[model samples]
Target: MSESKKILVPLLIALIIVSAFVSGCVDESSTSQSIQPQEEAVTEAETVTETTTEDVTEKETITVTDSLGRVVEVPKNPESVICSGAGGTRYLTYLQAQDKIVALDSTEDKVSVGKAYAIANSYFEGYPTFGQSGSENLEVIVSLDPQPEVIFTMYTTNGYDPDELQDKTGIPVIALKEGDMVQNREDMYQILRIMGEVMGKEDRAEEVISFMDATIADLNERTEDVSDAQKITCYAGGVGSAGSYDLMSTDSYYPPLYFINAKNVAYDPAAPKVAKVSKESILIWAPEVIFIELRPSQFEGENYAPYQLENDVSLNQLSAVQNEKVYGMLPYKFYSHNPDTALVDSYYTGTILYPDEFEDIVLEDKAAEIYGFLVCEGDVEKGMSVYETMLTISSTPVFTSLEFD
Candidate 1:
């Protein structure tokens, strides 16, 4: 965060009157920088809203530089918008601005209830599908009713260029970075602030940030005193990436392990964060415990890593497998990181690795607490209900010990 960026952000106030845009004097004022709307017009049959982005205007919009350093002008309190990436909607959920989302991206519409955020807010499925993550359907977008006032995209570099997308759709496009929960905390925090400014949820964004810092501190506080000799040697397998992977696919620097101070057997200071290792490597490392990423897709076939864990004779020889310490991890990546679930997994990991220190904690209640704050807007009953639904959907008790046939 440079001083210059801070200067641009303070100008993003929430008090801008949205009704001013309705009177029609500012017809071409949807975005500053004078970008024109797409030339391809939808026919009358497809025109849900006769007035497109070309007609949608705000009496006032503040200029804020996005994660990519593109200066975008968005309504101070945009009530109608489309979050343009799979994970972009996650931030809005944290901010309690789901009501602001007028339409869904392809992933949100198609894979409804697949992630913790989505499960907690299943009503999003009722919204019209706007576009896919990265690329959007410009025709459908420009024609939408309660027309989108701004476009917030998380994966800016994934597909359509933010500037080009704005130029084509005639809507302001705010690019956001999908920063990781670990290591990239600042990037993630910056995004929250940017969104908070746009949606007038500044205080809520800070609340989310404070919760993350305090929660991580509490996690470290619990196990920081554990000596190296007492640490549990662990490995996380079947780590999901671009495609399906078996047991050999893993991350040495898995974030949840760091939260609980689990010593990873595959950890190497110089190793790539993610890698595919040989079965022989696993035999030699012989981690005392192993965690596999649990996903609905993995349950579909015998070819996935979870299946390999049970069928592989050499793998069964490992101490962890013999001791029945193999566990299925709750879903971590849904399109991208769910900070809520990441914290939930961290607490669960602490309980498993340092049970005495985490003795007072109940995993289900902890998960509910996190979900309640992040998605359910402090509704514990709703959060707990969502958590129960997540568990049933996992096909097994993924957050706990597992049985393999």
Candidate 2:
């Protein structure tokens, strides 16, 4: 309890502390180093976990087999895409996915009015164009703001190489066939399904397919009972393919004719799908009912074939010309064979070939219904307005040839 005892006790405590450090029993620096590594280990573990999660997010995608048979991995439910070839945009429009279109081919911007899908989505005129029809400008595709995730191209030919396109744009590209509404119906449906699968619209794809199926079935059933003897021999001429052609341009197997049970007088087992019939050949196999496509030139007063029919007295010798059986069908081959117009053409042809069966139908109403369901998702109000807009660009199917008024 004295001053000397207090000093001795403090000196003894200091020595004990120094001796513990000298013996390395409580090495503070070693303990500090050990705690630092544990902290770093926890930080490293967190960094690894964060990086793994990011990799999974970056790789999230779905695999699709395009019409070209190319397997591609695309981002799940891509919100933006480019429809790049002939009927590529049309198929997307048919699936009611027109909103997904980020850019279009310049051809659509130029020929916006005539193509049915183009007509339905006229606002597309304002969207950036990727390139010309059947050909895409990869530079523009890649430079698009908010870059597109996928590209749907049709008719892979005409200078469009899907593989090269996909490579250059770094965007997944899907190629498709311009399959017809008839014989190759399944191919067309399959293309829609593939796209729908990629876009997460599988149900919509099936809905569109079922509508087409029901349409084809309805057309066939309506004319099913027409006796082969009673079925009129008909011909479709002035058909558009690649570009406009003269009156003699026709397609054998002329898809819609088969659906309506018309014995196409031009139906050739050996001829190319599209053939140029001679004026002389026409005289020998005169078709009783003639359906014609009003080419774009015709609207511009070129009157390519119709001028020949009305003025070429030699052609007047044909029954179709003389009896007024020649009718104007919608330009079904705009861009590609427009399935909606094909069906409308078939129905109109049916009214002429067998009116009693189509007596309950109104052509305008039916046309609107077709456009509404196929292009507008069964929204007839929108379909009705679109139909009116369509009339400005295309002839209403029905009426003697060249009589759009």
Candidate 3:
């Protein structure tokens, strides 16, 4: 009786195990089907995240607004570029963008812009030479070796439209004007960034822009306290129709003016862009300080007074003349109009106007700083020696202009 009972128990246990195995197999299939959609969703989410990360790494595009306020899209990295103005050359050099230049105009011919020309000669050796204003020999521009991808023009009163120029040359003409350059430094940085994009030198452009930002900040900190009371009115530009009394027109480049917070006697805020005063008018204003930008002829002219003092009673009566404040701002390099030049000119003028404010800076060191800043290899010390010698030879009442003419 006991053996039969054991066999029945074992048979019942085996039947129950077979039934559980069949149910578990069905459950496993249903669970896998449910998990497949979840897995698919996870895969889709991963794909979307990867796409978004890629977009984030892409570079930003730039849009430049021309003088007319038209927004134009430019290349993210232009391999070839052309600058049509002397001012533009300074910006390119400051941006370390000489490599991007495919062509440059002949604006460097004038002594006023010779430093830029010298830079081009030193750094941009075999590039094409586009003519200036009338010099942009249309034929030469059309024949550039590799052909330019873009052409840019600096701010100017009159110039050919870049778009039209591009249409004729099959290159995009991008205008980078400087009318708003002095108001905010952001404008300068933006232009440099845009140029970097066009020239494929964004990194160098940013570095240069940063350097300018820091330099300007340091300069402002040093010169912020300079007041109008301490400033000396500076007269720039070549003496106009008048001899020794002529001054630059109000609209001309007014360097060292706002830097020292000085009153510019020649400055007529209301003067039309073309308004120019005669020598008699300049004498009427008689600025406390006078600076002369002499041309070769003017520098050598018999009538020029940098060489003679006392006997020129006409000059002796002048306020600046009576005080020995008249200084012939010898052309340092080019016209002294770059960012460094502008600041240096302000420092030099500030010294002349208020010697106490810059007592620490001697004139010789100041001249050397300017030359070094401009990357001029010319011996600034020797140059200053020449200037000093010239001034001594010309400053006496007996010193008469030796006219070769």
Residues 157-255, model 2: lDDT tens digits: 567588877887788888877677766788888888998998888999998888888888898888888798977788888787666555788888676
Q: What is the C-alpha RMSD of each candidate to the true structure, in Å?
A: 22.6, 5.9, 12.3
Q: Give the C-alpha lDDT of model 2.
A: 0.78
Best by TM-score: 1
Cα distance off (Å), candidate 2, residue 292: 1.0
**Ordered list by TM-score, greatest first:** 1, 2, 3
Model 2's TM-score against the true structure:
0.82
- List model 1 lDDT by residue over 1-405, tens digit each: 999888766654422444455544466565532454332334543574655755787567788889999888887798798888857788999999988888888777655444777888888878888668666899999999989999998855578998889999999999888777766789999999999999989999999999989998999899889999998789888776666557887877777887877788887767776688899999999988888877775344565677787888888778888888888776675566677877888888888888999999998898889889998999988888878777764564587777665
Would you list the clashing residue pairs of candidate 1?
none
Per-candidate TM equals 0.83, 0.82, 0.62
Candidate 1 or 2, higher TM-score?
A: 1
Q: For candidate 2, what's the RMSD?
A: 5.9
The per-residue C-alpha lDDT of model 3 at residue 225 equals 80
Q: Which stretches of candidate 2 lie over 4 Å from their true place?
A: 1-56, 297-303, 394-405
| CA lDDT scores, all candidates in order | 0.80, 0.78, 0.55
